[model samples]
Every structure is written in C-alpha cells, then in structure tokens.
Target: MPRKFYDGPQRDKPRENCAIFGVACDDIGYSVSKLLYSGLIALQHRGQEATGISLLETGGNIYTYKRKGLVSKVLNNRVLSKLWGNVGIGHNRYATTGAKEYSSSYYLQPFHFKNNEIEFSLAFNGTIPNYAELMKKLEDMGRVFVTNTDTEVIAQLIASLSIGTEDWPEILRLTSKFLDGSYAIIILTSEGDIYAMRDPLGFKPLCIGELKTGKRNLYFVSSESCGIDAVDGKFLRDVKPGEIIHISHQKDIHSEMVLRTNKTAICQFEYIYFARPDSIIDGVSVVEARMRLGMYLAKKDPILKNSEITDNAIVVPVPDSGRSVAVGYAKEAKLPYIEGLMKNRYIWRTFIMPGQNRRKAAVKEKLNPIKSVIEGKDIILLDDSIVRGTTMRQIVQLLKERGGAKRVHLRISCPPIISPCYMGIDFPTKSELIAAKFYNKYGDSYIEEIRKHIGADSLLYQTKEDLSRAITKSENELCRACLTGIYPLKSVEKIREIEDSIAKSRT
Candidate 1:
C-alpha cells in the first residue's frame, strides 16, 4: 500500500471561483495594463489556473487578453507592452464548480456588453447559486448566450433591464432584484465611470484604496487588500457587504442605494484559511486572527495534560500560514520556536498543479529540509490546517531523517475540517476529506487518530473556542458550517437531490 495520508489536499477539492482586481487612475497617468498587472500579481494567491487583464482607454474603447496560466507566465513585459490604456480590470482564476472555460477569451472579464450602443466592462468574483435558473429565464427573453459564467448572465440581465433606463443607478437597481448568491464585482463604463458592489450576504471580500501618482487620485477595488498594496495604494476601507460603490474623476466615489441587502453571511474561511495574513477584511486583520489561534492552541497542551517536561519539545511551524501561529504558541508555551522546513518558493503550489502525480510531486518541489535548523530537536510542526496529509508526511520524514529529530509533533492552527464547505472554499465532496475518512476508520473524536494515521508522534489542533476567539467576530457573522456542519443558508435541497442520484451510482 502507498500509505497515502501524507497527501496534499487535491485541487480536486471544490473551490471558490476567481479573484478580481480593477483600477481607475484619472490623474497622474499610467498604462492600464501596468496597473492591472500589479493588482493581479498581489492577488495571484487567490487563483493560479488562469490570468487576464482588460483595459479601457479614457476615450471609452476596450481591449483584453487572458488565458489559463500564472499571471507572470501569461503576461510578461512584452505582453504588458502591448496592453495600453488608462483604466482596467484583471482576474486570476481557479475553477470551482465550472471548468477553466471561465477564463477563455469570451468568458474573460471585464465582460463587455452593449445594448442599443451603451457599453460597459464588468468583472466579477464569487458564484451565483441561482445561475442555471436565471440563465434559462434570460434565454427565454430572446437573449443569446456565449460563454458560461455568471458574469455574462449578469451582464445580459442588466442589459435586458437597462434597455429603458440606461443610467447607472437604475441599471444597478434592477440588478439587485435579480441576483442571488455571493458576488463582489466591478463595472467600468465607456464614459469613464466605474462601479463596484458586494453581495448582500458578503460571501466574498472587496476593498478600496487611494493611489498617489499623476496628481491623480485613482481608486482601486479588489478581492483583497494585498492587491491594493501591490500598486502602492493606501488601504481605505472594506467595501461593505451589500453596498454599491461608484468611482470616477467627475464625482465623489461612494456607495449608492441601488444595491443594499439586509443581514450578511461573510465566508468563514477568509479568517480560517484563505485571505493573506497581511490583508484586512471587514476591519479585521487576517494575520492577527491566525496568531490568536496559535496562542489558543498552546493552552490545550492536550497531550501534556498527562505528562510533565513538555518544555523540552520544540515548536516548529509548517511554514507560511502556520508561521504566525507557531510564534504565538512558542511564546505562550515558553518553548523554543524553530523553523524546521523551508518552502521552495519556486513551486507555485501542490494542489493547483493539475494531476495526482503533479500535485504530489509539487510537495517535494515546494519544501526543503532545514536539517541544521531542526536536527536533534523534539520538533513540533504547526500548520494553518491539514486538508490532506501528503506534505505533512514528507515533512515529518525530513525532520526525522535529515534534521535528525527524535520526535516530530504536529500542531494544527485551525479545527479539523470534517464537512464540505459550500460558501466559498472548494472542499469538493465529504469523501475526499482525510479528517472525514479518519473519523470513519477509527471512530474516534480525539485528534490522536489523525496522528496515528499519518504516523506522527502526536497532534494538537485548535479548538472551536480558539478558532472563534481568533476570528473575533460574533458567532452569527461567519459561515462556520464547514467546521460545525451547520449551513447558514438553507440546505441544498436541489443539489442534494441531484448528488444523491450520483451517490447511488457508486453503491
């Protein structure tokens, strides 16, 4: 047997769709392509499968190019050289329920749509759960479809309703009535106006910024604050959930009443795993949240509750996400914090690489044994969360073999993920879940079962209290359904009925 607990969570797990970045610089002039490029680079972590940029000249014409690949590989100096304009939007993508066709030239955003000569470029992030129903309804109204993306559906829906009232507010007003599910979107008009909106539920994140160039006070909107920082922009505030933000040189940028939804369902994973540590969403610091998780994990000291002398063990972070938590734990535990593994910056990622072989191979390419750093130490490896144990296994072996560590204890920064996340994460089915698998195989709620399965000396996971405290939001504010299996939205009665049919095929 291959003994495969040491696995990278397959990109095979389902995921949220694409990241969006848009910039409108009306003052100290710069090329649209350059601005979009910087914003996309900042957001590369949000997607790796494909990258694209769309440019809108001050005069109102637009040009765009996008394809499946990393941002740098797809758009180099030569490529950016050809892209010219004053305002633009860009996207880095990861396929979720749909395929990569979403990034195809036609599907690429900012999706340009026109009716009776009025034109606008729209770029959208997040998914529309009601797209299939909406698509059929739109198709009945003599609207033809091109690419399969909610963005196009939205564009057409706006066009159909905007036929009579072409002004921005009325167009957006009607849009609010037809949309369902999570969305953070940006729209650029031929007349040089830009609009950004987030869904009422706020299942995704969007932020605004001010840039200091060309005496031009450019406004920025993106899936994360990291993107804003990439272009040397000042982080303003998060685009509130349900708010519609409008930007332009001629008028003060502000959110309009055309789109506003009561209540919210912010994606819980943004704090647990997704958003970059440096970024802040909805007024919360992502890095601060993770560090709190570390401090919380240290208090449990579950295994040490029975034994003394735990002081000798080292606290090692799994690298990247785990680093902050490990630091927090080390301080709380009064233990030595060590960097036991070095990440191979060259490897983009393991899961996003495509095939099983390639995903597993990426583990090797992405990590290096810091033998001198961890050797002869009782190592404790901390990670944000353990989706699948692939890289975890190799990491343990490296510490034991190369670093000469006697014991490799593991610490998880987040609670075990046992259910599929429907909000934004691409968790796929329950079966692809290693924690779910272990829960079935060993019938133990204690995390020790996971340690045994992965051949680890021991494992410590952050408790629900720890995780909640780290996020620092009201329990009602986040979608903790994946962690707690309590779907905030109604049960997927429709999806379950269809999926149940598929499950029968396996049986």
Candidate 2:
C-alpha cells in the first residue's frame, strides 16, 4: 500500500549486507507470511536498514510488502495480513551499494519485476563485485533499470536469461557464469514456485530446513540455520555452493549443482562477527569457533598465560561480539572473567551509525565501564576485530582515564585486515581500514603504532593459521581476503577500482 520509496543518508559499518529467507508449504492454509516474519526476525542482526517480503497467491497474483526500517517496525500484523500465500520470499537489507536516500526503497528487495510473459520477485544476500560491467552489458542489450543497486541488475539479468526457457535452473547456471562475486539469492515466481541459489565460490552462507505441520510439510531456505531454529524447524544441511534449489507449488523440493568449483570461500567473518552465536555455518558452530579463537589466541600469546598478568588482570569482552571469545580466553588463560564493561542495550552498533562524529558518540553512549570492577586493575580486553580503531581507542580511553584501569591489553580474534572486502561485508577500501592505513604509514612498525594509537599497553592479533584452525576449516576453504589480501576471485583490479570510487564519493 505504501508506494512511495524513501531514501536517507548512508552509514558505514561492518555490515553482513543482507539476509534472504524463503519458504514453500504444501498446505494453502499455512501462514507463510508469519513464518517469513519469524525467520526474518531471527536474522534481524544481519540487516536493520530495511525489510521486505513477496508472496505468491494460488491464482498467480504476486504481492510484496517492503519498507526501510527494522523488521519489527516495517512488517506488522496489518502488513502481514495483506501478504497472503502458501509460498513467499523475504529480505532484510543493509545497503551495500547505491545512495542511501529515502527514495532508495526502489532498491529494497525482494525486488519484483513483472511483464505479460513472466514475473518473479527476488531477494539476495551478498555483493556482486562486477556489477557495473554486468549492468553495462544489460544496458547494451536495451534493458532499462530503475534502481542503482546490484540487486536490480541481477534481477533484470535473470529475467533476460529466462526469456527462452522455463528451465530456471539452467537460466541460473548461465547467470552464474557472468556474476563475479558472492550471492545467495531466493526468487518467488507468480506461479508459486520458489528458487534459491548460491554463488560458485560460496562466499556467502545459505541453508535449508523443513517444518512439518499436520499432513503438510514446509521447506525453508535461509541465510543461517538460526532462521530455521526460530521457526522450530528441523535443521537440514547447507545449500551446496553453486547449487540451485527449487520448491514447487506442490511443496516438492529439488536441488541441482548448477556450478562447480574445487575451492570454496566461505567468509570467515561470519564466524568471527556476522552470524548469531547460536547459528551453525558451513558445518561449524559460530559459538564454538569463537571459543576456539580465544583458545588459539591464548596458546599463541604467552602474556595471557602469565600467572602475574592473570592474577591481577580481569578478562573483559568488548560486549556482544566479544563476549564468546572473552569467555574462551578466560577459561584458557585461567583468569577471572568479569563483565567489566556494561553495554547500553538501547543503542545500535556504533560502527553502523552514520558519520564519524555520530559513531564516536554512539560508542560512548553504548558502553560504560564498570568502575568498581575495572578500577586499579589490569584489563585484558577481547574484541572481534579492529576496523577503523576509533571505537577501540575510545574504549581504551574510557577504561583508563575514566574507569581507572591500570593497563589495557587488547586481543583480537582475527588477523589484521589489510585488504578490502568485495563479497559484501563493507570494509570496502584499504584507505578506510585503520590497520591498512597504519601499515602504509608505519611500515613494519604498524602493530606497535596501532597499539600506541589506541593507547593500549599491548595488542595481539590471531594468526591466519590459528583463525583457520579455530573455524575447523582449511585456509583455502575460507575467504580471508580482508586479512591476507589474497582474494578468491580474480577481479581484484575491478574491486579496487569500485572501492576507490566509493571512498571518493564518501569524501
């Protein structure tokens, strides 16, 4: 009913970019909208900027409801009542590209495109690094685009490819050959058919699940296993890399390996920061992986094991993202683990807040030191990763200057981020990364310099080998491109160019 698309200014943060959810049920009476709402709510952490859902009715009419906001705010009971169907697809979006204007609702997906011949709604998670080139090719073929976002480009491309064939899997396989980056996308057609597909390299996460109600069985495809858990569904395995899964109106499911590659590049950040702790990704529990990271960090750093340090220092997590690893570190180091900093539950993530000033203010507002716990004590601070270093520096200053911490030793769960990410997690340019900037400025003394900059007594980062071990995956199987500068895809030059353009535009 809300036809007006609103656009607002953009923010920079370590974003998962988006989350996609889809379900098809054999029972027409099943409330697919409610199930989609539950699944999207479970994945709310993946994206808070916007939410959308597309439903296909039995008579071949497609309905979509979407708006810019949190899922709870955007999709209410009244809205859900309007989105009726046995099959539906949903999306939670955090803008990875395009202008963040109020009118940008045009970009909010499950994007629907309709014509006399065919119609479908698409929701996608992940970035297409070669979007400009792909868009250019489509434009050359006389395709018109309304939104600047890559989702529209992808949707149009799929529509164009679907022209000659009803074999959607084959069309997707052909589409996969032209796409050069990460994506896990779900599509709902007017005929009540749903299709889910992942990129060839598997840079993003997607999983399948099943829920049984009476005589009807419902199938789900989501960005994480937690979505399935939210709906009380049985956990099924991940959608294989380069696989296309189809769910028909009859609730029959089929999967095809449309693309194949020997190497898979699951984004490691999904374990370290992006995913819910309760979620299992790529056969690894995110919570356990974080704990292993702490154990590995403790084994690598003798200071954590030093009795003197452990006796006087209290292990404190940076709150939320750092909690799991801090607990792990405390156990391995034989130190006291305490909530030395209390997070203000009301505030949003500082990194996602728009502008440097707002981000700084949000960090101060979001975290407050427990003076009685931290005062006159040595503090071992555990955090997931250091991006811009602004928030970390602020926290160090808060603990020392305000809370009277004698010393602050910082430990990160992942290796230093030296390269930009193109697959969707938003650390787009080396220039915007504190580690890369410090490395460029201080050369071999970068680590010490960053420690000095953050006012930490000492700083230690996990090694790449240790990170791989922590996730229980080989280095080649993960996308550590941001840490090691070796991208899984061969579009490094193109990604850099795009990132540079983005950086300049931000300025």
Candidate 3:
C-alpha cells in the first residue's frame, strides 16, 4: 500500500475541504451581515478551516474580515455590526497550501487588494491550478502581491488593468485569459458592484436568487441554493458556467457568458460530497442523487442481493455529508434508520487541526457508535465516499466490537474514485487511493477486492450511470471525469500517464 501521512492501524486519510457562498444587496437597512452568517452556516460542509465575509457600503468603501475558524466562532453579532453595508460576499475555505503557515494565515480569503487609486476584496470557491503561470504574468506586469491565494491572483489582475474601463465584462475577459485552471469567484469593490463568475468548466457551483423584504426584493448570487434559503431568499437557478454577473444599485445589472474554452466540466464530487443536501446544484437535488446511489449499489453488490433488508437492518451514516443518503437508503431499502455515530461537535476541521496526528485523533474522537442503536443488529454503513479504507475499517470494527453489530455491509454514495481531481477538490493522487491499490495488488477489478480487504461482509458503490442519472439534466450537462477519466482540459502528459497506469485503464 502507498503509505500516507495519516495511515496507521487505526488512522485514515485526511478529509477534503468543500463549500463556498456569496450574497449581495442594494439597500443598507437590512441585516445583510447576519443573513450572510445564516447562509455560510448552511453551506459549512463545503469548507470548515476558515470563514470570511466582505462588504461594500454605499459610500464607496469596502470592509472585510476572515480567519482560521468556524463561521459562528469567527463572526458574531458584535463583529457583523461593525461592518455596515448593503452589498457583501462570503467564503468558507478548504486548504490547498501544504505548509502550516499557509494553512494558519488569516490573510488568505476574501483576499483584499488596495492601492491609492482603487480597492477590492474577493472570495472564490474553486482553484486556479495554473496560478504559478498567472503569477509570473502579473509579476512581469509589476503587480505586487501579498498572499499565496489564487483569489489574490485575480484581484491583482483586476487592480492593474481596470484603469480606464468601467466595464466589468472586459475586466473578467482579460483576467480569464491568463487563468488555465478552475475558478468561480465573487468580486466586491469600492464602486458598489459584486461580480460572480464560474469557470468555463463549471468545476464549482454558483447560483442566483432574490430576498424579499416588506416592499421590494433584492437580488444575490451564491455557490449553493441553501445559502440563499438561509436569508429567506428564493432560488432562481444556477449561474451558467463561463458567465459573469454584475450587481449594483445604480447600474443596469450586467451578465456575459464567454468561455475561455467551449467544454463544461462540472465537478462530480459536488453532487457526492460538497453541496448541502437541501440545496440543488445545476438543477440536481443532492439528496436524490445519494438515494439513487444506495439503490444502485443494492442492485450491484452481493451483500444487498436477495437479502431481506427490512426494519431489522440498521442503516447508519457518517454524519453531516452522509445523513441524507442514509435517510434515503433506509427508506428505500426498507431498513430502519439509526443515528449510530455520535460526532464530536467541538472538533475542528482537519485543516484547522495543528498537525497530522491531531487530524487522525479527530477521526476517532469525531465518531463513536451508539451501543444502544446497533446492539445485535445487521448494520449497513453509509458514507459519502471512502478515500482510504483505514477510516472505514476502523469505523466498521467499532460497529462490530463496540456496538455489537452482527454484520457490517459497507455502502458508498459515489463510485470508486480511481482518479485525482486537478480542479478544486483536494483528493490525493491515485497511488494513495485504496481502491486503486487493491486493484493493483490483486490484478483484478476494484469493487470485490476492496470489500474483502476492508473486512466488510459485502460492499456496494454508485456507478457512473447512477451518478449521471441522479442529476436531472442530460448526461452531457454534467462532469464525471473523476469516475470516467474524461478530463475536459489539457493534462500534463506525465500525470495522466501515471494515472492511467495505476488505474490500469486503457484511456
């Protein structure tokens, strides 16, 4: 097995960060900041390391505050009251920086840029994998930068070139040309405009909505629909990938959909792990997708085949991400839903834990089986996806020994992730993935081999067809690259070569 930093007998691979949110308004009377807090809390699963909000008041002034903590801990009523504005954008971040300093810096997001002439702050949901190349381009142009964020990269690009142009579309066009990786950003400025744009691939999620007061309603944009629902906003639909939305009090609302490339490559992990269960992305309900995933797995895996999974079998979910899927599975498979795992609400995200050992310790402390819920019952364990089997194995052992489960049937809501994502998600390379490792050693397919190794009675996984069908839109409208290996952009030949060899895939 390819050893990872957090792989001991009881350790598991680290969890990936997820989630992003943005909101804007025209009037100053509303508690827009509090509204933003509600939205961020609902979208917290997308990211937990840091939470931030940026506001642009009516008087051409922008204020922003962000740090390494949860949304509630970082911003309270006192903090929100200090920054007064009708227009704002917020972000919850997952870490991409390898260093502890990079992870700990409060200066990371809603990354603000100011000069004698202009000022702006931005919060983004996706990654720009070619940020190194973009930084070189900016440095060549004499634009100085303070932080190591792709959010900063775009801010500098905008600050340097926005000289004579009052046009937001032109600014976006100039910036998008230099970026070769995924980015979905919200830009707030001294000029009272908030700009939201998804990359050409739609590798991140962004949506539009309206919030109603007594008389008139206000318009806004966000990464997920639940954020809008937090402030009593009704969802309109997803912002088209490769489109930019410009919102302001005075100017006519502006929108433009010009792509750096023609193809759209939305992230499959969003449907499987990132987005909130209540919110729909790209017209697909995340809750429904998870339900379908369980049903599909039931049809494919031997453990579920011909087994009378009635009210006797207890369905338990890995909390937060797996909750809705567990509910759906329990309902559809005619099983009893049991809240068996008790998550430590006090535990910080893996990104916030000071070291690798702390994160590994957290996985143990974060979940424990409720002995009463699983005593002497067959347990079907549901999780969003299993990265390395170490955590799953530990979790299963807990069910068998501590909770007295008769048998453990493992269920995953997504297909075996045979490839790493180059866009925004932070999954490790395939060499470290358990499914890939099992396939390599056994010289066979992954499903059965992984089940046997994990000590599960049987295992079931969602298929590419189930993933696609789970989305209401046509198959062509979604991105299944991680499962299908159909990358929509240019690949470093060596990385792709290694990925193909490890998966033993023909492509």
TM-score of each: 0.89, 0.93, 0.87
**lDDT per residue as tens, model 3, 381-417:** 8888877676677678778877788888888887777
State in Å the error of residue 122, model 2: 0.5
Q: Whole-model Cα lDDT per candidate?
A: 0.73, 0.84, 0.71
Candidate 2, clashing residue pairs?
6-102, 6-103, 7-101, 7-102, 7-103, 8-100, 8-101, 8-102
Model 1 C-alpha lDDT per residue in residues 1-507, reported as the tens digit of each score: 000111234553334556898877765256767778888988887877778877776566877688778899989999999887777788877654344444356755557786665787788877665676788999999989887667788888878877766578667767866776667888877777778888777889999887766566678888999998998889999988878888775564677753544556787678767788899988889988877888888888765553443645778887676798888888888788877778877665455675656755676677766777666667777887776665576667667876787787788877778777655456646676678778867777637777876668888877777677788876666666667766655434455567669988889
Model 1 compared with the native: what TM-score? 0.89
* Number of the top TM-score candidate: 2
Backbone clash numbers for all candidates listed: 12, 8, 3
**Candidate achieving higher TM-score, 1 or 2:** 2
The Cα RMSD of model 3 versus the native structure comes to: 4.5
Q: lDDT score, residue 163, model 1?
A: 76
Where model 2 places Cα greater than 4 Å from the true spot, the runs are 1-13, 97-102, 249-251, 352-360, 497-507
**Candidate 2 overall Cα lDDT vs. reference?**
0.84
Cα lDDT tens digits, model 2, 1-507, are 111111223233366778999999988876699999999999999988889999988687888889988999888988887778899999998754444353466777889998766799999988776787888989999999887667888888888999978888888888888888788999998878888999988889999999876788999999999999998998888988899998775847788665789889999999999999999998999999999999888888767557777778999999888999999998998788899899999876555566767876787888889999999899999999988787898899999987899999999998988886767776635676789999989999999999999999999999999999999999778989889887888665665667679878998
Clash pairs of candidate 3?
Answer: 18-46, 18-47, 19-46
Ranking by TM-score: 2, 1, 3
